[model samples]
Target: MTIRVVAKNYVKPEKVQDFLGLCKSLVEVSLKDEGCIDYGLYQELENSGVLTFLEEWKDEKSLDQHLNSSHFKEIFPLLSEYLEKETEVNVYRKTL
Candidate 1:
């Protein structure tokens, strides 16, 4: 079954724009991955520093592959530094 993931990041107020820019490349790369069905980023309308990712994957195994990818490893450190708190990642499956 396809998996849907929502990841919310509370970024440092000053670095919000920078973080968004960084994610642009990450999104591009992720979307090109074989396992990624869809990937995109969004900034909360009310809170500029809050960023969220809406992603869909082919399956849990694919999502696991994505987590272990080189791009993920590279961006994680940068993301960690600018994040105000730990990222909140919620996963789900579609139901008929």
Candidate 2:
């Protein structure tokens, strides 16, 4: 089954640009990983500092691999410094 992941991040207003730069690196590398179906980053128009990461993977193993990827391990902790609050990450499977 395909896995979908949505991660919502509230970036500190002063760190939005820094956050974006890091996200760019993260997304760029993540897209090349095996089993990555899709990986995209989105920002809220109404709230520029609010960002979201939408990802799709081939299966549970793929998602787990991604979570354990070098980019994820290195970048996610750095991303936390720019966040105003803890990120909200949710995983789902298509039922329809």
Best by TM-score: 2
What value does the lDDT take at residue 71 in candidate 2? Answer: 91
TM-score of each: 0.93, 0.96
Q: What are the Cα lDDT values of the candidates?
A: 0.92, 0.95
* lDDT by residue for model 1 (1-92), tens: 99999999999999987898889889999998878999999888999888999999999999999999999889977888889999999999
Which residue pairs collide in model 1, if any? none
Off by over 4 Å in 1: none
Candidate 2's C-alpha runs over 4 A off are: none
Model 2: residue 13 alpha-carbon error in angstroms: 0.9
Predict model 1's lDDT versus the native.
Answer: 0.92
Lowest summed lDDT window (length 10), candidate 1: 72-81
Q: Count the backbone clashes (under 3 Å) in each candidate.
A: 0, 0
TM-score, model 2 to reference: 0.96
Residue 51 of candidate 1: its Cα lDDT?
A: 94
